[model samples]
Target: MKKEVNIILAGSLGIILGIGLFGLRKFLKKKSQDYDDYYADFHRHFVKQAKDDGNDGIEFLAVQ
Candidate 1:
């Protein structure tokens, strides 16, 4: 009976950890992709302005 209870507890813990890890991975991947998009958009929209406007349009950060 004790052994059976231990097995059940271990199995439950494993399943919960697995689910948490899967969710964490998906969230991180999406965040990474979003950052890539944000930087691409910033470069596309701002680089030309910086060049055209000279020092007046220089930017170090972007907000969406």
Candidate 2:
């Protein structure tokens, strides 16, 4: 009886850990995508602003 209870507890713990890992992976993926989208948007805006500045032959430095 004790062995069966231990097995069941172990299985339950494994399932819980698996679910937590799955949720973390999904959250990280969504956050990464959001960061990528924000970067793309900023890049586009920077390029557009540079183009509008009318300095066609000059390169701009990106300040971090």
Candidate 3:
């Protein structure tokens, strides 16, 4: 019946959309974690370098 076909099509569309959204969320979460890790490593390296060179890190703010 026509009504049954419409219901089936709507159901399938909803399921596809849900799956797409879930996949996007997972991908973003992973990318965010990667970015955080990179920032931490960079900060550590910068601090170590500053200390080795006898500096206490940058306290002066840059003028915009």
Candidate 4:
């Protein structure tokens, strides 16, 4: 009986940890994609303005 209980507990813990890790990976991937998009948009806007104003533009840190 004790061994059975231990097996059940271990299985449950493993399943829970697996689910948590999966969720964390998905969240990080989404955040990385969002950051990439933000930077691309920033560069596009920056280049457009520089062209319009006829001045070489300097790159600054991207903001949200």
Candidate 5:
């Protein structure tokens, strides 16, 4: 009886840990995708602004 109880407890613990890991992976992947989308939008705007202003984007890189 005692061995059976231990096995049950271990199994439950393993299941909980697995679920937590899976959730964490999903959350990180979503956050990573959000970051990539933000960067792409920023790049698009930066290039558009540079083109509209008639300046090569490299001038912004000069040390002040």
Candidate 6:
């Protein structure tokens, strides 16, 4: 009986942890992609303005 209970508890814990990890991975994946899009958009707006204004050209340097 005791061994059966231990097995059940362990199985439940493993399942819960698996679910948590999956959710965390998904959330992080979305955030990572979104951050890139937002970063590009910000740079794009600035570049657009500089491109339109011949005398207001800007230089861009991206460092990882």
Which is the leading candidate under TM-score? 2
What are the per-residue Cα lDDT tens digits for candidate 5 across 1-64? 9999999999999999999999999999999999998887767744633236665477676843
Clash pairs, model 4 backbone:
none
Weakest ten-residue segment in model 2 by summed lDDT:
55-64
- For 1-64, candidate 6 gives per-residue lDDT tens digits of 9999999999999999999999999999999999998887667755634345444334432321
Which scores higher on TM-score, 1 or 3? 3
lDDT of each: 0.82, 0.83, 0.83, 0.83, 0.86, 0.82
Q: Which regions in candidate 2 have their CA more than 4 angstroms from the true location? A: 44-64
Top-scoring candidate (lDDT): 5
Clash count (model 4, backbone only): 0
Q: Write the per-residue lDDT of candidate 4 for residues 1-64, one digit (tens) a residue.
A: 9999999999999999999999999999999999998887767744634245554355533331
Give per-residue CA lDDT, model 3, range 1-64, as digits (tens). 9999999999999999999999999999999999998887767744634236554456633432
TM-score of each: 0.61, 0.64, 0.63, 0.62, 0.63, 0.61
Off by over 4 Å in 6: 42-64
Q: Where does candidate 6 clash, by residue pair?
A: none
Clash number for each model: 0, 0, 0, 0, 0, 0
Give per-residue lDDT, candidate 6, residue 36: 96
RMSD of every candidate to native, in Å, equals 11.5, 9.6, 10.4, 11.6, 9.2, 11.1
Give the CA lDDT, 0 to 100, for residue 56 in model 4.
39
Question: Which parts of model 3 have CA positions greater than 4 angstroms off?
Answer: 43-64
Model 3 pairs whose backbones collide = none
Candidate 1 residue lDDT tens string, 1-64? 9999999999999999999999999999999999998888667754544345444432543421
Q: Which clashing pairs does model 5 show?
A: none
What is the Å distance of residue 29 in model 6 from its true position?
A: 0.8
In model 4, the runs with Cα more than 4 Å from the true position are 42-64
